[model samples]
Target: MGTEPDIILETRQLSKTFLGFTAVDSVDLKIQRGHIHALIGPNGAGKTTCFNLLTKFLEPSQGQIFFDGREITRDKPAEIARKGIIRSFQISAVFPQLTVLDNVRIALQRATGLSFHFWRSEASLRHLDGRAMELLAEVDLADFASQMTVNLPYGRKRALEIATTLAMEPSLMLLDEPTQGMGHEDVDRVTRLIKQVSAGRTILMVEHNMKVVSSIADRITVLARGAVLAEGDYAAVSNNPAVMEAYMGTTQGELEGIHA
Candidate 1:
């Protein structure tokens, strides 16, 4: 096989263009199984664009994508999702009107092929409560299980989102800025939650918070102007001149400060 068994996802010369502007250039990415891989870049570095391409929200203009040694370049979003590639958006995606546990139960319904079965009696879905509670506990949200999702604190909402994603039993979870717009306490809390939930699963995240990346990312790929600028553990990428320059005003001292 051309792909290493350890690589759960791979992109070969992946590219995306809008009109004449190249959003994501020919970039190759490989995410190792059971690792937290961070994709970081400056503003307009095409980080989100690349995530969109991987999840098949936007078809690539050129190149190929592989998931678990299988070419998925042409797979539709739902198809890839069924293949265990679950993506969580930058914003918390949950049903505000539903209880926290119910949000996760809805995702669990997919595995039972009852996702569209809203007319079913409430008892039919109660069977999912135990597993849903387990998932919520995994994210430290079990105490809020009965609370309405809309009233959850921002960080808890993100945690609930993670619990729902886990309900799908994703082999590879793509988290897009899971910690954005959070206060320091929430940032640290979610950061720990991400690490906690990453056991036995691979995570590929687009994150701007260096502290989170430094603490948990097993590998980091730095993107600049739609191209790979650096690839390494936090220590390597943070000290690279190009990566430092890409951040412009972010002095090397500041980078070093987050080097946990």
Candidate 2:
């Protein structure tokens, strides 16, 4: 018999509600190891809620979360993060006043599990600077290492955020709209950076840009209202008339309708 696929992350009957409102309802998701999975949907489709549940930001009202074969549904956010699951929000989550090197240095220190040495000279902290520089180079931000994070372009800032997150050495990274407000050029740069960063790590992203979704997603899941509308390869989703009509709109709907 063929061996069962090892699931890196799994959620069964995942759901969330606020008072009497249902944001996400009975959503089941599975993600394999070392793949880039993209979640696409219109606004108010519970994409953010899903992200929150996965990262333990909000406890699921009626579901279970498993990571690497262990249950994580009830775990605290920090506990989950320490177990190699890190998340980045839609907004830029960085120290705007700090230099690029300083930003990355702080991340490295956290990843090294050294949070108590907050007052020590980072330069003299046992290869912290060297490690920080290496991560910067990995994310193509070495050239801007000494520059203030706020001074860099939007695209560069996004890249730096990824570099900082990488310092945590996450096994799976959940990104919520990493390119939400970026212009065309910056969007393209973030896409390329995501591909480069996914070399050995698994990534789950909620993206609205169809172009970015088509370019880098190894698998796609379309969400609508509050559940999985469709899940398949690029062509399958791109050709599904219902998916196109519901999520991608009339343009994609027309194209995919014919193809379907």
Candidate 3:
């Protein structure tokens, strides 16, 4: 028997076009298992388009996507999700009115194929609480398990989203702009939380915060004008002249200051 591949997910010549304009131009990506890979680019650089193609939210105009050594370019979004690629925050995964623990419980229920059974007794669902709390603890939201999810702070809401995503038991977690808007403390908390939860899982994140990327990413792929411009560890990518010029323009000094 063959050994499992080191690449958990990969894209070959992935391209997408709209109305004769290309959004993602022949982008190829290889995401190694058990590593946090960051996809970063300046605004309008096709990062979101690339993510949509990978998740099957938008069909690729050309190229192929593979997960776990299987071609999945033709799979639907739900199909890819079931294949262990879960995109968090692309859609809100938590219910505002539900308690934090209940939010996770719902996700667990979905994963177990019991999501449609609303008629199931509350007592039967209580069994999911322990596991739900564990997921909450993984994102450092254990103490807020009983609180209404809507009442939690913004940063904590993001954490709850992570917990709910975890309940789906994803092997590859796609986090879109995990720290898009936040204060220093919240960013630090979520950054640490992401690193902590990445113990056995592979994470592919599109993050704008250089500090967050430098701190936790095992590899970085820099995009420019809808194509790959550079790929390396934080240090190598940050120091690349092409990346510095394309991503930060003339402000290369600011780009060099970002360090893990």
The backbone clash count of each candidate, in order, is 0, 0, 0
Worst 10 residues of 1 by lDDT: 251-260
lDDT of 1 by residue, 92-174 (tens): 36999999988888888867788878888889889999999999999999999999998999999999989888888899999
TM-score ranking, high to low: 1, 3, 2
Model 1 misplaced stretches (Cα beyond 4 Å):
90-92, 256-260
In candidate 2, how many Å is residue 101 off?
Answer: 0.9
Winner on TM-score (1 vs 2): 1
- Residue 102, candidate 2: alpha-carbon lDDT: 84
Task: For residue 82, give model 2's deviation from the true position in Å.
Answer: 0.6
The residue ranges of model 2 lying beyond 4 angstroms of the native Cα positions read: 1-5, 89-92, 253-260
- Model 2 has an lDDT value of 0.83
Q: Whole-model lDDT for model 1 versus the true structure?
A: 0.90
What TM-score quantifies how close candidate 3 is to the native fold?
0.95
Task: List, residue by residue over 1-260, the lDDT tens digit for candidate 2.
Answer: 22226679988899898997888888988888899999887678888899998888898889888888888889998899888899964222788999999887778877767744778885566577788889899889999988998899988988998988888888999887888799989988899999999998999999878788888999988788888888987889887777767754666544332311
Off by over 4 Å in 3: 1-4, 90-92, 250-252, 256-260
Kindly report which residue pairs in candidate 3 clash with one another.
none
Top candidate, metric TM-score? 1
